[model samples]
Target: MARKKRPEGTRRPNGASSIYYSEKDGKWHGWVTVGVRDDGKPDRRHVKRKREAEVIDAVRGLEQQRDSGKVRKPGRAWTVEKWLRHWVENIAAPSVRETTMVGYRSSVYKHLIPGIGAHRLDKLQPEHLETLYARLQKPREQGGKALKAATVHLAHRTANVAFNEAVRRRRMVENPARVAKAPRVEQEDIIPFTREEARGLIDKAAEIRNGARYVVALSVGLRRGEALGLKWSDYAVKWRHGCPKGSTCRSRDASKCDLREGRGTLTIRRAIQQRTWQHGCDPDGSCGHRLGAYCPHRRDGGVVESEVKSRAGRRVIGLPHPVIESLETHRSHQEIDRERAANLWADEGWIFTNRLGRPVHPTEDHRAWKALLRLADVRDARLHDARHTAATFLLELKVPLPAVMELMGWSNAAIAKRYMHTNEEFVTAIAAEIGGHLWAEEDDTDDDDGPATVRLAI
Candidate 1:
C-alpha cells in the first residue's frame, strides 16, 4: 500500500490556497485556484519553494494577481513577435487608417520583431526593452547601419502600444515597454516662403499645368493628398444674390455656379495614399512572398482614398477672393480641357484632373511643383512648404491661434507652432513703425542737439 500522505499543514482559508510539505520533492508547496478554465476546471496556480515561508509568499502573490485581474491566461504563452503580428493584423487593422497601420506594421516587422520578438510576452522585462533600443543605436559594423533616434523612438512607441494592448487582452500582467525609456526625436527644419515669394509664386503658378492646385496649396493650406482627392461635389460656392456693377449673379451656391464669380468653401473629405496589401492565403504570410504586393493572392492595395488624418483635418475652409478667382479660372480651363478630351474625358467630377479628366497622379503633381518653383526663380521648397507659408502668413496677420488652427486643420497648437515661422520682414516692419512713431523721419546724429529724444522710465 502507498505510504499515507502526511496530513496537509493547517488548511488555509479560501483564496489563500493550501500549503503542504511534500516528502518526495522535499519542498514546501502551495496551490491557489486563481481562476476557472473554459472547460469548467479550476485554473490552479502552483508554487514550490525550498522554504515554507517562500512558498506561502509566492501563493500570496498569485492571490493578489488574481484579485487584481492581472494574471496572464493559463497555457497561453505568446511571443513578442506573435502578439505584434496579431495586433497589427487583427486588433489594430480594423480600427486605424491604412497609412497608420502601415507604420505599425513596419515598426513591428523591421525593428521590434528582429530585436526582441523571441521573448515571451508575459516574461518581457524593462531591461530587455532597453537592451534592444541600445543595440538599435549601436553603429553598424558588418553591414547594417545604426537606426536613427527617430526610428528607434518609433519602434519604442509601437512596442509600448502593442504591449498595452496585450495587457488589455490579458496576455501580460503589465506592460514592460512603458517602463523602458524612449529615444529622443529631434525636430525637422521646415522652409516656408516670405510674403513676397508667395505672391511671385502664385503669379508664376498661372504658367503651369494645374497651377490652381498650387494656389490652393499656398492660400488654403490644403495638403497635396487633400487637393488630389478633391471632388467637384465637395465645393460649396456662395454667390452674391445679385451684382451691384451690372454683373449677373452666377448662382446661389457652388453646385449651380458657373465658376465666373464666387467665394465659397472647400471641405476636405479624403486623402489619397498608396497602401500596402497583405497576403490573403495565410495570416502568417508564409506562402513565399515577403511583401504583400508581390503575393499573387493579394486582395486590396495600391492608391486608395482614406479618411483625413484626423477629424480636425476634415474641416471646411472659406476661400480668399484671389483663391476664389483662381479656382474659377481653373474651372473654366478644366472645361476647355474636357471639351478637348471629348470621349476620353472620364468626368469623375474631380476639381483637378488630367487632360483625360482623370485625377492628377501624385508623382505628376510633384513634378509640377518642382517645375513651378524653377520657373518662378524662387528658392526650391517642398510642396508642403506652401502650407507652412500659409500658416506663417496667417500668424503674421495676427490671426488668433485658434482661428489659424482651424484654417490649417491643425490638431494641436504645437503643430501650428512648428509650421509657423517668423520671418525677418515682420520684425523689420515692426521696428520701422516703432522708430517712425518715436522719432522724426531722420536718423539720429551723434550731435547733442538731436530732436526731442523719446526716453523711457527705468
Candidate 2:
C-alpha cells in the first residue's frame, strides 16, 4: 500500500523543523537534530505522543534546553541496570582494592540493581529512590528484608555514585539520588574492655598458641588484618646484651641476650584478605572458565595481599616490654612446632599460623578469639574492640590526643575522639580536680547554737 503523505502545502504552526505529524501512524511526532556524528550522520531523537499538543510541548522543552546549552544528545537508552553494570565493570573496578571491589559488586548486584534497576537512567526520580528505601525497611515477610541501616546506606551510596558518573557522561541532566533520603545510620557505642578485663583476656590468650597475636592487638591497637599479616622479619628487636650503654656493638651472637629485656618495633605494611578474583579468566582466552563454584581453579575464591586500609594505617608501632617478651616466647613455640612437623611444615614465615605453619584464616582467628574470651570469663567483645580498649586506656591515662592519634594510625582526629570514651573513673578524677578548686573546708565551728553557717566564697 502506498504511504499516506501529509496534504500538500501543509506547514507546521511555528515553522520549526522539529514539529510534524505522522499520517501513516496516526500519531504526532517531533524530531530534533542534536548534533552530527563524525561519519556525517545526524544524531537525532524522535519523540512521539498520541496528542499533537503534547508533542509540541515536548519539542519546545528540547528547544529551550538546546538554547540553554544543557541539551544532552540522545544515545542508546540506558537503564539503571545497564549503567550500573558498566560503571562497576569499567569505572569502579580499576580504582578500588580487590576487597572493596567485592563490596561494590555485591551492593550493585544484590541490592541496588534489584531495587531500582528497572528505571531509565534519565527518567529516575528522587521518589523512585525514596520508595526503594521505604521498601527496604520492611520485613521480609512483607516483601522486604529489613536490612540494617548501614547496608541500606551502602546501597544508597552505590546508586548515588553510579548516577553521578552517568551525569558526567551526559547521560542524565542531574543525579536524582543526591536528593534521595536514606535511613540514618546510628553509631554504635564503643565497648572497650576495662584494664583488668584486658589483662585477664591477655593472660588467657597466653595459654593459647597464638597469644602474641592478641597482645599485638591489645597493646598496639593494630587492626585484625594488620596483626594477622605480620611477618617475623617485620619485627626489629633491640637487645640489651648487644651493646654497652651508648656504644654500638658489632657482636653477632644469637644466644647472648636476656629475653626479658628485649624491646621491639613492628612495622605494618600489608593486610591479608581472601576475596573473589575480579579478573576471573585470562583476557587472552587461555582459560575459558568464569570465576564461580564450578571453576576448577580458585573455586574458593582468591587470596589477596592488599595495602593497609589507609595511608595512615601503615605504621611502625613500638612494642612494650611485656608484648615483646610474649612474642619471643611465641617464636620459640613456633620453632618447636616446626621441628615436630619437619617436612610437613609449610613455613609461610607468618608470625601467627596454623599447626602446619600455614597462615591462620581470618575465620579461624575469630574462633580462637571467642574461645579465649570464654576461657577468660570476660564479657564477649569483637576483636576490633581490643583496638578500642587500647585507645581508651591511652586516653584515660592522659596521653595527648595527638599522640594517641599517631599511635593508633588514625588519619582523622574525629575517629580517635569517637573511639576513645571516658569511663566513670576518669570522669570521677576530673570531677575531683574541679571540686578541689571550687570547694574549701568550712572553718571549724564550736558553736552548736544552730547549724554552723557554711561560708560561701564568691
Candidate 3:
C-alpha cells in the first residue's frame, strides 16, 4: 500500500517549520534550512524522513536561544607569522635553552617567514608546505649546493611543530604540515677515528703552524666556543686547604692548620662569550699604557652586547687526563711569558689568549681547526665531530649508557641514544651465535643415534 504524504503548513512544538520527506536521484534526503538569500528574500529547504528527527531537535534548540547568535562561523584565521610570534612569546621563550631559542628564531626568520608568512592560516594547505619542502631540497645560492636530507628534515620538523601548537591553541582547526610528506632522511653513519688515526692526527698537529689549536680540539671535545672561551681560572688545578695555626708543611695532622695547593679537578663552570683587552694607564706621560682596539663587542668603534649564544650552552665537562696535562703544560709556558713582561704585561687570565691576553672569537677557532685539519691531511668534518668521537669511544669501551649520558651532560636517554650506534663486529658475532644452533644438522653417518650438542656463546 502507498503511504500518503503530509500537506504543508504543519507546525512542531518548536513552532518554526514542519517536517517532510522527498525523493531525488532514487534516494531520500532530509534538510531544514531558514535564512535569507542574496536577493534579500527568504529561502526554505525540505527535510527528509531519515534526518527529520535530528532536524527537529536542532530546530527546537535554535528556537530556545534568546541571546546573541553567531554572526559568522567559528574558524581559524591567523597567519603563520602571527602564530609563530605568539608561540615564541608564549611557549618557546621560557622553556628551552637560550641557544635553542636562537636556533628556533633563526629558522623561523630565515627559512619559514619568507616561505609561508603571508598565507592565511586557513589558506595554508598541505600543497604550500610541500612546495616549501621541495625548494629547500634544491641548490642554495652561495655554493650552488643543496642541503642534506637531514637539514631539510630539521627545518620541516621545526615548522611542523610550530603549526601543531597553533592547532592546539584553536588558532587553526587543522595542521597542514601534518599532511605534508617529506623524503625519507636517514642519519649518517658516523666514521669514528681509529686509535691509529687519532694518534696520527695528533702527531700531524704538532707539525702545523698553529699546532696547539688542534691539540685543544683533539684533547677535549670543546665545541669551538668552549675552547675559544678558555680562561686560566677555568682549569682549577690547584686546591688550597684550610690549615690550623700550628700545622707544619710536611704534617698531615688532624689538629694542625694546613692549607696548600695540590692537584684538583677542572670544572667547565662558565664560558666567556666576549672578550676585550684593557691596558692599565700610568698617570705619568713617561709610562703610557694603551689598550688594544680589537674587541668582540666593537662595531666600527661602537660597543654592542647580546652576542652570547645561550645559557644551556654554558655547561660543565670534566677534563680528561690528556686535557689536564695539556693545560698544565700551556700554563707553565704562560707563567714564563708573564714573568718576562713584568709591569708591561696584561693581567687577563685567559689560557688560550693572544699576546694581548684577549680571548679568541668563535670564528677564529673554526679557522684554526680548518687549518689544522688541512695540515694533518684529514678529510672534511664538522667541528661537532669531536663530541661524537668522545661519545663513540666511551661506548666502545662498554661504558654504561647512564654514565655516558651524565658525562655528556644529557639528562635524557633519548638525546644520548642518538649517539648510540651498535658496534658492527659485536652485532655480527652476537647474531651468528643466536642463529648457529637453528641451522645445525645431525650427522647421518653415525653408528648410533646420539643427542646433538648445542653450544651457546656468551
- Give me the candidate number with maximum lDDT: 1
Regions of model 2 farther than 4 Å from truth? 1-74, 140-146, 241-260, 276-303, 400-402, 440-458
* Candidate 3 lDDT for residue 404: 76
Per-residue lDDT tens digits of candidate 1, residues 196-269? 89999999988777899999999878988899999989987765533344344443443453443566899899
Model 1, CA-based lDDT: 0.84
How high is each candidate's TM-score?
Answer: 0.81, 0.76, 0.58
lDDT (C-alpha, whole model) for all candidates: 0.84, 0.80, 0.59
lDDT per residue for candidate 2 within 116-231, as digits (tens), equals 89988888999999898877777877465688888888888988888898888778878898999988999888778888898998888889989889988888888887888888
lDDT of residue 358 for candidate 1: 81
- Model 3, 100-202: lDDT tens digits are 5656776687677888889987568889878887887798778777767776676677778888877665466567878889757986767655545566677
The window of 10 residues in a row where model 2 has the poorest summed lDDT is 277-286
Range of the 10 consecutive residues with the lowest summed lDDT in candidate 1: 242-251
Candidate with the greatest TM-score versus the true structure: 1
